[model samples]
Target: MTTLLSVQDLAVARGLRTLEGVSFALAEGQAIILRGPNGLGKTTLLRTLAGLQPVAAGQVVHEPSALAYAGHADGLKSALSVTENLRFWAGVFGRTEVGPAIERMNLSNLAARPAHMLSAGQKRRLGLARLLVTGRKVWLLDEPTVSLDTQSVALFAGVLRDHLGAGGAALIATHIDLGLPEGRILDLTPFRADPARKAPRGDGPVGFNEAFA
Candidate 1:
């Protein structure tokens, strides 16, 4: 039940678009579902949490070894086999074991298959499997179920449950219901940037404010 991450009054921005007034704390074994309409900065928020991008303001506090991120783009090498990709990530993350992760993802049979040869669902599964190799405490996931089927989605849910069962937390930005047994939902609509403030011309797409304005 320890707090793994704390984001206080955070503001995440992309070009002229900004999402402000964000605050949340993620505890061990807890999951937070980030729910918001498109272009409300859900992805941007995840990026900010992952430290892959800068936050315009406020504070993000988390241990360096406690965070792992999985974005829309699966971090996989197309030229490598499934095992090879996992092995590479294991090496990068300084994890000595890869067998359990492969088994956990149900990718044992496809171990020798090149990533490019796998179907979309299989590839997505592999992408998710990489999260386990890092052994990080907090997972920042963006649309983790993009191309998964019913079975694959179920597998993912089980994986998430197991991760939580092991005292790891996740912040998932997804529109689909993941069927997690326990978690909290965080809606970001209230955090939309001020409408009165004009953004630079063509800085980004019109958001909640501009659409109404």
Candidate 2:
């Protein structure tokens, strides 16, 4: 399989607190489960890989627009209906199909409901649905199973499997089991930064390669 992303001797900083060394490569159709104790930079690592945050050092190489990220904050407009929210994401990702994504997440029945009216689980379902329209080759998800019921989690696992089947790779930072027994686990604990380090000078713009370093 083709390599989708490569990370070499990465150092991700959270306000001058640099994380421990990190290095890994994601090949097409592969999935890596990020495992580590809280405060060990699991979320930081995901944000870095998503390009939402910058890396302090090391190199991250991938094709432009090849990544899609879902973080702790569900990027949704409360006033928008479920369908409208998905429509907006589809437009942003240059995709024309919103029905399949909605259906995939089992949100068809809630399509007309305002986002604010949905329960926590429903909102999470919607968040996961957004990933479908991006057409990105790599998925960087942080705690994707949060608020999802068992059935919803199953659905998510199925979606992930399908993505891999289509040659997409994922780096998921989650504490819960996503039902991917074949997925590899990446422990971030070994790369945890020292607490005594001084804070960095300035916060940089968040992006794919620049997030964690």
Candidate 3:
């Protein structure tokens, strides 16, 4: 299969701390689960790959416009209804249709409800649904199952399977098993940056680590 994303000796920073020597390639139809204990920089790495943050070192190679990222935030407009939110994102990506995405995410029932009225899990589902209208080939998901119950988790897994089956790729940072039989795991423990190496001071404001701290 064709490689959709390639990471070469990537070193991602969370404030002054860095996680280095990480490398991986995600091919079409493949899903790679990012595994490591808390504070291991899984989210940091995903953010760097998503271009939300600057990379500390090394390279991430992919075609422009190939990536779609979903983090903890739903990235929704509170005033918009579920369908309207999807429609907005679809329009951003130059897509004209969102009916399939609504149906796929099981959001059809809640389509007319404003985002502010949805519960946490419902909001999370709405967040994940944005990925469908992106039309991007590679997905970078961080803790995608948060707040989702057993049934919704299964629902997400099925949608993920369909994405992979249809020639897409994903790099997910998640704790729970997504029940993907073909999924591969990349443990970040071995790739942790050397604590002894002095982290370069940043000239700008403190980054993700300090904010969370």
**CA lDDT scores, all candidates in order:** 0.84, 0.84, 0.87
Backbone Cα, N, C clashes tallied per candidate: 0, 13, 0
| Candidate 1 structure quality by residue, lDDT tens digits, 101-172 | 899989999999999999999999999999989989898888999999988888899999999999999999
lDDT of 3 by residue, 59-164 (tens): 9999889998888788888999999999988998889789999999899999999999999999989989999999999989999999999999999999999999
Give each model a TM-score: 0.91, 0.92, 0.93
**Candidate 3, overall lDDT?**
0.87
Tens digits of per-residue lDDT, candidate 2, 134-176, equal: 8998999888889999999999999999999899999998877
TM-score, prediction 1: 0.91
Candidate 3 residue runs with Cα over 4 Å from true position: 200-213
Which stretch of 10 consecutive residues in model 3 shows the poorest summed lDDT?
204-213
Top candidate by TM-score: 3
The lDDT of model 2 is 0.84
Selected candidate, larger TM-score, 2 vs 3: 3
Which candidate has the top score in lDDT? 3
**Worst 10 contiguous positions by lDDT, candidate 2:** 204-213
* Candidate 2 stretches greater than 4 Å from native: 204-213
